[model samples]
Target: PVKDSTAAIGLTILLFIIPSKLDFLHAFDKDPTKRPTKPAPALITWKTIHEKMHWSLLFVLGGGFAIATGSTDSGLSTMLGESLSGLKGLNEIMILFIVCLFAENITELTANVAVANIILPVLAEM
Candidate 1:
């Protein structure tokens, strides 16, 4: 596997440029259509990307990061950690079970990264 970031990115660029230049993907076309006498529209364009982008999901994730930062800066994570520190006396399996249950429930309401960002500092303290 390529471990270098630059090499990985270079490989990705080559894959994209090579296919576009050679029309390599046409080999896999399942829909055989008549050849057009006139030019056809490009498959992807700036307008297509703009309309297809999920702007709301970005904002939701950004908000989640902001919340995580606020919680850490405001010592909410410390407080939460202190509250859960009592669990040190509990069995490791019980602690793991509780964490999984909490994560499972919270994940239903938000993105996984959002939950991780919010919970990481608290877990670190614990």
Candidate 2:
């Protein structure tokens, strides 16, 4: 029910911290009707953790966040806006369409939210 970022992060952390003991792999019986009242003890192992964790994806997302933070901190977002000032003579629709294409291409290589953070400021300044 909560839409707050802090709440979202807390809930995500809770899934790991609170449910770390649940043996989800062996939670239910093989038969469709046979079910355990509670999950078995967790079978924690390095291999299991490795298999379950999205480690590489986490780095990629971190890099995206870093890129967005860096661009904002370095004033590149504002510079982009200023640079686009010269293109004022161009059709507004064309300008937005071009920006959208650029954003979409960057997003294909990284994360869409990161690209949005990088590009939204430029559009706002315009």
Full-model lDDT for every candidate: 0.70, 0.75
Candidate 1 lDDT over 1-126, as tens digits, reads: 667878977865555444233344444566555333344344444576589989988788777877777877898777778887898889989988887788789889867776787677667766
| Model 2, C-alpha of 122: deviation from truth (Å) | 1.2
- Candidate 2: give the clashing pairs: none
lDDT of 2 by residue, 27-77 (tens): 566864554567543335456768999998888788888989998899987
| TM-score for candidate 2 | 0.57
Task: Please name the candidate that would achieve the greatest lDDT relative to the true structure.
Answer: 2
Model 2 ranges with Cα > 4 A deviation = 1-13, 16-49, 104-112
Model 2: lDDT of residue 73: 93
Q: What's the TM-score of each model vs. the native?
A: 0.55, 0.57
Q: Which ten residues in a row have the lowest lDDT in candidate 1?
A: 34-43
